[model samples]
Target chain A: MATLKDVAAKSGVTVTTVSRVLNNRGYISEETRDKVYLAMKELNYQPNEIARSLSKQKSNNIGIIVPHIEHPYFARLIGYLEREAVKKNYKIILCNSHAKFEKEIDYLEMFQSHRVAGIILCSRSVDIGKFVSLNIPVVSIERPVDVGTTSVECDNYQGGILAAKHLIARGCRHLVHFSGIENEAMPADARSKGFIKVCEDNNILHKEVESKADDYLNMEYHSLIESVLKENPEVDGIFASSDLIAAQVIQVARKMNIQVPDQLKIVGFDDVSIASLVSPTITTIHQPIKEMAQEAINCLIKCTEDSVVPSRIQLPVSLIKRETT
Target chain B: MATLKDVAAKSGVTVTTVSRVLNNRGYISEETRDKVYLAMKELNYQPNEIARSLSKQKSNNIGIIVPHIEHPYFARLIGYLEREAVKKNYKIILCNSHAKFEKEIDYLEMFQSHRVAGIILCSRSVDIGKFVSLNIPVVSIERPVDVGTTSVECDNYQGGILAAKHLIARGCRHLVHFSGIENEAMPADARSKGFIKVCEDNNILHKEVESKADDYLNMEYHSLIESVLKENPEVDGIFASSDLIAAQVIQVARKMNIQVPDQLKIVGFDDVSIASLVSPTITTIHQPIKEMAQEAINCLIKCTEDSVVPSRIQLPVSLIKRETT
Candidate 1:
C-alpha cells in the first residue's frame, strides 16, 4: 500500500526521481537509485507496474474483455470495476469481444503488443492457453482459470438452486428452466445443473428450454419462448437464465394472457436494475456485482505481487424476490 | 483508409520502419523517412495515433467521463463507444463524476496526470473554463460546453415539446412533468422548458414537478411522485425525465390501482434497453446513441488534429410510441 510519495519521502528524493529510479529511465545517480530501492523494499512497495510501464513503455494500458457493455448485468459489473480501477489509478482498455474467437485473440494480441498492465477477461470464451502464452497477468471475471491465473466468479450453482427453490416453495409443479447459450463456461452450465439437481431432490417434474441468445437481447429468445410455450403450455413455473431473457418471457406470457405468479411463477437470474423496473417486477438471483468487481481488482493486485492468488474464487449469490414469485 | 502495410509496401520499406516513421520514434534514415512520408501522403494513410502513442507513452489509453455509468442511458452509450474504441484498437479508462463538479475536476486532473491520450466527457459537471485550460481534446456527450470543445447532444427541447404534444393528443387535460435535478446543465432541463413552452402555446393547464434524484436510480423518484400526486390529483398525464423514473411511476400507480392510459398517460425519456422491457412499455424520446457515440469519437479525433469541430451539435430525437401513452 506504500505509495510513490511514501517511497520518495523515505528515500529523501523527489517523487519524479523515485519514479525514474523505479522505471530505470532518465539520468539518476547510482547512490540515489540504491536509496530508492532500499526504501521501496523496506516499505514493501510494489511500484504500479502498469503506471511504471505506462511511463517507460509508453502504453501501460490493459484491456478489459467483455461480451457486451450494454447488457444490464455487464454494465453494472463494468461500473463497479471501473470505479475500483480508477481508484487504483489504472486505465482500462475496454474490449467487446462480441463472443468472437478471432476478436478475442485480436484483443489479447493487441494488449500484448500495446503493453497493458493486465487482462481482465470478462468474456465467456475460455481460451486461457493463448492468454497464458502471452505471459501477462490474466484475471478473468466469472470464468475461472485452472492454470493459476487469478479469477473472480460468482456461485452460479447456488444461484440456480436459489431460483429453483423459490419457485418450488411457491408451489410450482410442472416447471421449466430457460437457459442461456449451452456448452459454455461453468457459470451458465452450472446454473442449469443446479436447477436440475434441486428439482430432482424436491421430486418436481422439470423440463429445460435453452434460449439461443448470446446473453440476453435477441429476437430468437421470443421465438424460443413461443416454441417452448407450444410444447409446454402446462408449465406453471419458469426460471430464466438472465433478466433480459426473463423480460422476454414476461412479454410472451402477457401476449398469451397468462398472469404471473398467480398462474405461472417465474424467476430470473442476475437481478439487474430492470428486475424491479419491469411490470410484475421479477424474482431474480443477485450476483455480488460490487463485491465481485472489488475482488477481481484485489485478485489482480495480488497477482501484481508475488502472492499466490486463487485461480477460482466463487462469491455468494442471493435470490431477491419481487412480485413475480 | 490505407493501412500501415500498404504504406510500407508503397514506400519499399518494412512495416516496423513505417511504424517508426509515423510514430516519430527510433532512428531511421532520412531517405527512408521521406519515402514513408511521401508514400503515406500518396496512399492517404492515417496513422493510428493510439498504436503509435502506446510505444511512446506506455499506455495507449483513452479515458471516458460519464455522470454515472450505472445508468442505462450512459451505460449503453459507453458500451457503444467502447465497441468503437475497440475497433480502433484503443482501451477505455472509465471515470464517473456522479454529476459532481468536484468529481469532474478530480477526474480531469487524474486523467491528465495519468497521461490519457484524450477524454470523452459525457455530461461533464465541471465548468467550461477548466476544460479549456486542459489543452486536451475533449468530446462532450449530451452537454454543451461554452468553450470551443466539441459536443454531441440530442435535441432536448424538441423532445420535450413532442412529449407534451403526445400527451395532448392522448386527450390529457391536466398534465404534470417530472423534471430532473435543479441547475444541472443537461438536456433534461431544456426538455422541461420545452414542455412548458409547448403547454403555454396550446393554452393547456400544465404543471411542472421537478424531482431531483441523488443519481439515476429510483430512490427519490417514488417519494417525489407520491408528493406530486398528492398536490396534483387532477393531473391526468405525466412526463418523466427518465425511463427509470417512468417505471417508478408505474410502480406507484399500481400501488394506488390507477389505470395507465385510461386514468393517466405516462411518457419517459431515453428509450434505453429497458424502455420496452418494462410493463406498459414506455412512450419516450429516442436519442440516436450509436450515431452520437461515433460523432463524439470523430469530433475528438478531429480536435486532436487541430481541426475546428463544432462547439454545439444536436442530433435528432424521435418520439417512439409504445404502450404507455
Candidate 2:
C-alpha cells in the first residue's frame, strides 16, 4: 500500500503541498495537481477514506469480472451477486473483460490500484497465470483460475452426462455433440469429457463439432452443423453445450427441412430464458444461477473473515425437459 | 457533499480524531473507527481522491443508473457504453436500480457525494424533479428525466408506425397491439401512440392489451393475450411494444395453436438477439444500440464542455423483416 509520503516523494513535492492538493484548501497550479494525481496513481496511493478500510485488511467493495454482461447467464449472475453484496454491506464494481486477456489484465490492475476487498471472476482469460500475484482475496465463478482459490461451478460434467442419457432415452442411437474447443485455463470442457465417456460406455456412435471461443455469432456453428449433418445423414440426436447453440441448431435444422424430435431429438445446456423462449422450448440442463452467486459471495466473505476458503464448490445441475426431446 | 468536519461533528469526535482515523495513523479503538466510518457514510462524505476530482470541476469517473443489467437491451447498451467510456479514459460505476425508487435515490446520493463527472441514466424512476438539483452534468439514456436534460431515445413512435404499416401492407384487416402501460416519466409509450393513431386514421378495427411496469414474468401478458385472442380471433396482425413481449406472445400463441404469419402476423420492438433467436425470427424495429450508446456518451461529454445540452435525441429505428411478418 502506497502513502501520501510516497506520492510526495515521487512527485518531488513537500508533504504539506500534497496534503493541500488532497484537501483542496490552498491554491495549486494545474500542472502541480496533475503531477500529484499522476504520482499518486502511479504509486497506488489509496485515498484516506478507502485507505482506512484497506488498512483494516479489506474493503467494503468487491470487484467482479465476467466475460460479457450481455450473456443471459452472466447478467443474471451479476444481478444476484449485487443483491447479495448489498445485503452484506458491500458494493460491487463490475468489469466486463469481453473475453480478452489484455482487458482482463487492465481490470485486474485497476482493481489492484483501487484496492477492492476481493474479486469474483467468471473471466474467459486463457492466460491467467499472473493472477497469483494478486494480493486480494479471490473467488472464482464457473471458470477455474488457479489451484488455491475456491471456485463455484455447476456440475458441467454431470450436466453433459444427463444430456447424453436423455438423448439416448429418447431412442436416438446416432448422436452428435456440439462442444467448444478445449481450453486449459477453463475447466468447462469437462462437458466434452462426460459426453464422450457416456457415448463410449454405451457403444453409441457420436460426432463432436468443436467451436472456437468468442464465437458469439452462430456463423461457425451454422457451418459446422451444416457440414456435420451433411456427412452424417443418420445423426438423429444432438446435444448442444449451450441453449444459444441449440437454438441455432434448430434454426439450421428448420432451414434444412429436418423435423425436430420426429427425425431429430435435441437437448441443450444452461436453461436460461432463451431455452424456453425459443420454438419447441428446448429440453436443457438447468444450472442454478442464483444459488451459485450466493455461494460465490459466501466464499469470498469467508476468505475475508478466515483467509481460508475451499478449493472448489460444485453446485448440482438438473435436466429440464421441454418440448425438444 | 459532507466534509470531514461534518463527519467529526456527527460522530461526536474531535476533528483530529477523525483525521487520524481517516489517515490510519496513531492508535484508534475499533468502536471509534466504526463510528467514524458510519458518520462519514451518514453524512455522505466522499473519499478524498474522488472529492479532489470534484473540486477540480470534473472527474474521470461517470455514474450510470439502469433499470437492471439482466435486461438484454440494457446489458448490451452497457457493454457499448463501457467500451466507449474506456476509449475516452473514463470509468463507469454501474448502479442497477432494479426499478426501485429508493435504490435510485441511494445511487444518486452516492454519485453526488462521490462527485462523478456526469450521469447516464436509463432509470425507471418516475419522479425525477430532484435531479434538477444534481450539480453534475447528466445524459438521459432511453428514459428522459425532465426538462433541460439531454436524452437519447429510439424513435419508438416511428417504430410503431412502421410496424402498423407493414402489417397493413401485408394485407392484415384486423389488428391488436400489446403495449406497456403508459408512463409519464418514460416516453416509451409513444410506440403505442403511433400504433393507435395510424389505426384510427385508417379506420381499422384494432385492440390493445397493456401490461404494467416492472411486470417481467409476462403473467399479465399471458392472460391478456389469451382474452384478447378469445374475443377477437379475427385479429390478423399483432404488434408488441418490445421484443421480449413479442416473444412471449409467440409462446402463448403457439400453445393456443395459432400459426404465426399464417393466421396472425406479429411485429416486435427493440430487435435484441432474442428476436433472431426465436423460432419464426421476429420482424422488429432495430434500435441502433451501439450508435445510441456512443451518442449518449457524446452528449454527456458535451455537457461537460458546455453547460447546455439538447433536450432529446431520437435515433432512427429500422424494421427487420424475418419469418414472422
Candidate 3:
C-alpha cells in the first residue's frame, strides 16, 4: 500500500508539507498542492481517515438515534436524512433506542466516545441534562429540548387546526381526535390542543382519546379504535395523530359496516406512504419531512462551526386531500 | 477530558501500561487491571475511540448499504440488523445507494477510507471485482456475489414453491405471476424459476408479467398491474414477488370492482409489515428476515477473524396464510 511518506518522496516535498496539504491546515502554494495531488494520484495513496480524525478531533459521521426504524414515519425521515447528509459529505451512524431511556443513555455515551461531529435525536426519552453535558452539537427532530440543543419540527398545532376545519367544512357534526401516548411531552401533543380549540370555537361536539405506549410500540390500534367507534356511533369525523392510526381507523370502520367519506370522514397526520396505500386513501396533513431532515442536518453543521444556531425552527404544513375526505 | 497520562499518574503506572489496558492488546495482571479501572473511574476518563481504532487498524463500525431505506422490507431488515449488531458491540454506518451504480462506488470508497471492520452490501449495482480487490471482508444480503465475498439470502426458490402450492391448493386454475425488473440478476429471480417449474408440473395455465424498473423504484405498480388484470380476465390467482406489489394489486382490483379471494386469490412474497397492514391482510411467504440479518452479521464478523468462511448461506422460508388466500 502507498503511504504518506511515499507520496512526499514522489512529490519531492517534505512529509510535513504533504501532511499540511492533506489536512488543509496551513496555506500551501498552488504549485505545491498540485504536485502533491499528482503524486497522490500516481501512487494511489488512501489516507487513513481514523488517524486523520484523531488528529483533527472530529469525524465526518453524525449519530442518529431513532425510536423505531421499522415505523413508516421514521423510515421515511431516515431516508431523507441520508440523502441530505450525502449532499453535505456526512455519514450517519444509526441507533435504535426502542424508546427506552437506558438505551438512549448508552448510545449517547457511545457517541461521545466516538467523537461524532454531531447528533440528531429522534427519540425523546432521555433527559435534556445528558445532552447538555455531552458538549456535542445536537439537533432534535419533533422533540423540543432545552437551551443547549437545537430543534426542527413541523407546525403540529397548525396541522390540527387544518384537520378540524376540513372535517367541519365537510359537514361533520361529531368529531373525535385520536392522540399519541399520554404524558409523553412530545411536540405532537400540541396537535390535540389545536384541534380542541377549533372544535370549541365552532360549538361542535368532540372527544379526545389517547393511545397507550404499548399500542404505539406494537403499531396495533384495531381493538381500541373499534371500541371507540362502537361507543360513538354518531361520530362522523376523526383526526388521528399518525397515518398508522388513521389506517387502523379505516380498517375498524370497515369491519363495523361503516362507509368512509359517506357515513364517516377521516383526516390523518404525517402523510406517510400508508396514508395513500390504504383502501380509502386517507386525507392527511403533509408534514415537511424532507425539509425538516435537511434543516436538522444544516443546524447541526452550523452548531459545529459557530455554536449560535437558532434554537427552534418550525416549518409550515399543508393539507393533502385524497379519496377519504 | 482526562487523558491517558492522567490515568497512568493516578494509577501509579506507565502510560504504555495504561494504553495496553485500554486496548486489551497485551497481557496484564488482574490486580494491575483493577487498579487501572479504579483510576479511570475516579478520574472519569473516556478513551477516544478514534485513536484506539487507529492503533488497532480497524473500527467497530459496520458499513451497511441498502438500495432504499424507505422501502418496508429493507427498513425492517435494517431494524433487525441494528439489534443484532448491538449485541456484538458494533455500530452501523448507514448508506442509501438508491440503486445507483455511482452511489454504490462512492460509498464503497468511503467505507475503505474509514477502515470499517466489514461491509454489508444490500445493493448490487457495483462490480464484484471492486469488492475482491479492496481486501475487506464483505457480506452481500439477498444479492449474490462471486468469489472473495460471502452471501446470505433466504430460500427464494422454496418461497416461490410455497406460494405456488398455496395458491393451487386454494382451487385456482388460472394464475399470473408479477416479477421484479427484467435482467437485474438478483438472487430473487430464482422465485420465477421455482414458480414456473411448479406450474409446468401441474400443467396449470399460467402467465408471467415483468414489472419495469421505474415501477419498482417509484413503488407505483397500479397502472401496470391494472393493465395486466384487464388483459388476463381469466386469471383467477396472482402471486406477487413483493408485498408492496401485492398491495398495489389489491388496490387495483378494488378500483376495478373485483372482489378479492372471491373472484381472485392472491399470494405475495417477503411478508413484510405491509403485507399484514394492508386491507384484507395478504397471505404470503415469510422470508425469515431477522434470522437472515443475524446470519449476515455473524458471517461478516467471522470473515474478519478468519479469511475462510462459508461462501453462501441460504435460510429457510415459510408460508404465512392470511385473508388473501
Candidate 4:
C-alpha cells in the first residue's frame, strides 16, 4: 500500500531518485540505492503497475469482449485464450456484452480508458462502424467486421461439408439441416450453406429447417427441434448447427421412438465437451478450439506490437465420428 | 493519445486549470471550460484512467480468479457476476488459476500489484494459508477461506439432501453417489456428506463410488463412468456431482441397455444448459448461478469499500426433474 513518494520521503531522497532505482534507469550511488531499498522494505512499497503503464502509454493487459460467458463454446474459447494470454505475460480484462450493442460500445470505451494494449472482440454485437472507430487492434472470433482487424475463425463451410458428406457416406438419402440465424455473419450460417452445397453437389434430397434461436440455449433448442420435427416427418438424416442442437435432436428422437445412427444419422458441430458425455455420443465437427484460441491471441499481440499482420486467419475443421453418425 | 499538458499548452492555460475543468472540481468560468474543451477536442486528448487511479491509490476494477472458465457452471456464474459488476460501475480483471496453487498465488500477487479493488477467488487450488498474508478482501466461492473474508456459495449440503430425497421419492431402492474428488473443502463433498446422512436417516442401502477424475473434463467423466459401472454392478440409482458426469452415466447406461428412470434412475448436479439439452433430460440439482454470481460481485464491492462487510451468504439450490430420475 506504500507509494513511491512515501518510500522517497522515508529514504530522504526525491521521488525521481526512487523511480530511477525502481526502473533501473539513471545512475545512483550504492549508498543511495541501499537507502532506497531499505525504505522500500520498511514501507512495504509495491511498484504501482498502473503508474508504470501510464508512463509508457501501454499496459501489459488485453481486454476480451464476449457475447455471454455462459455459452459453453465461448467459455471454452475464453479459457484457452486466458491460458495463452497468461503464457504471453499479459493479463486479461473480461467483459460480457450479453449480445447487446450498447454494452459492447461501453466495453470498448472502458477498454480504451483502461489503456488496454489491445482488445479481442469475441462478441459480434457491435457494428463495423463502431468497431473500426476505436483505432485498436481487435481480433474478432467470428464476425469479420472491417479490413484492418485480425480474425481467427474455424472453417464453417468445410465443417458443414464434412457433416453432410459423413451423413451421405452412412447411406442417408433424405436429409434435413437444422439451422439458427440466417442473415447474420455467423459461422452457423456458413455451415448451413455448406451443407446445402454438399447436398446439391451429391444429388441428395435435402430440406432446410431454420430456427430463430440466438445460439444454443436449452429452451431455444427444445422449441426449435420440436417445430422442425413437426414439419419434417419423413426426414431421416439430420445435421445440426451446434452439438447442443444435436443433443436436442437426440432428445426429440427418443421421445418419438426414432433410433439414432440407424433410423436417423445425426451430425453436430462444435465437438464441445457434452458431445462425448451424452448418450449415442454425438458425431460432431471438431473446431480446433485450442489452436484457434492461441492463434487469435498471438495475432492480437502481434498486431499490438507491429500492426502488420493480415486481418483474417481461418482454421480448419474436421469430423469426429462418434455413435450418432 | 494526447495528454492534459499538451491540451493546456495548446490552450495557453495552466495544467491545473485544465485539470480542474476536466474534473469539474473548481469554480472555473464557462469561457475557460469551453476553451479547455476546445483544446482537448483539437488535440484528441484522452484522460488516462490508469494515471488517475495511481494518483487516487485505488481503481474501479475487481479481480476474479477462477479455476477454469470453460466449465459451464463457472461460465454461467461469471456471466452473472460480470453483469452485476458492470451495474455497480466496476470492471472485472479475470485470472485463470487452472486449478494450480502457484498460478493462483501469482495471479493474486499480480492483482495486488495492480491495486485491484478486491479479488473474488473461485479457485479450489489453495487453502487459507496462501491468502492469509494478503491485505485484501478475498471472497471465495464453494470453498470459504481466511475466516474474515466474505463467502457466497450455494448450500451444497441441502442440494445433496434434495437429490437424495428426490431419488427416494421416486422409489429408488438402491442408490450410489459418484464424486470426482475425494475430500477437500469441496461443495461436492458437502453434497456427498448430506446425501450419506439422508440415506442413513431413511435406512436405505447406500453406497458411494468416487471416480479417478481430478476435475470436470469430458474424458475424465468417460473413464469415471466406465469404472463406476464396472465396480458397482448393483448400483440401480446414481447421483453424479455434475451434469456432464450424469450425461456420461446415461451414455454408459444406454450402452449397457439400462433404461433411465425405469431400470437405472440417475440424477446429476449443476443443471447446466446441457442438462436439458441431452436426451432423458437429467434430473439434477439446480445451482442458483445468477443469484450467487450477483452476490459474489456485491460482496467483492462491499469488501473494496473502506469499511469491509464480512458475511457468509448461502444461496439456495433445488431439484429440477426432467426425465432421468
Docking class of 2: incorrect
DockQ of each: 0.34, 0.18, 0.78, 0.69
Runs of candidate 4 exceeding 4 Å displacement: A2-45, A125-135, A213-219, B2-45, B125-135, B212-219, B307-310
DockQ of 4: 0.69
Estimated TM-score for each candidate: 0.84, 0.81, 0.95, 0.90
lDDT value, residue A36 of candidate 3: 98
Residue A113 local lDDT, model 4:
79
Order of the predicted models by lDDT, top scorer first? 3, 4, 2, 1
Candidate 3's residue-wise lDDT over B75-104, tens digit each? 999999999999999999999998888999
True contacts kept of each: 0.47, 0.36, 0.78, 0.88
Question: What digit string (tens of lDDT, one per residue) describes model 2 on residues B181-206?
Answer: 54544445788889888898888888
How would you encode candidate 1's per-residue C-alpha lDDT over B222-323 as one tens digit per residue? 777877887888989999888888888887888778888789899999998777887788898898999998888777667666788888778999999988
Regions of model 2 farther than 4 Å from truth:
A1-59, A125-134, A182-187, A217-220, B1-59, B126-132, B182-185, B217-220
lDDT accuracy of residue B156 in candidate 1: 92
Off by over 4 Å in 3: A24-39, B11-13, B24-39
The candidate, 1 or 4, that scores higher on lDDT is: 4
Candidate 3 chain B least-lDDT 10 residues: B125-134
The models' CA-based lDDT, in order, is: 0.79, 0.79, 0.90, 0.82
| Candidate 3 residue pairs that clash | none
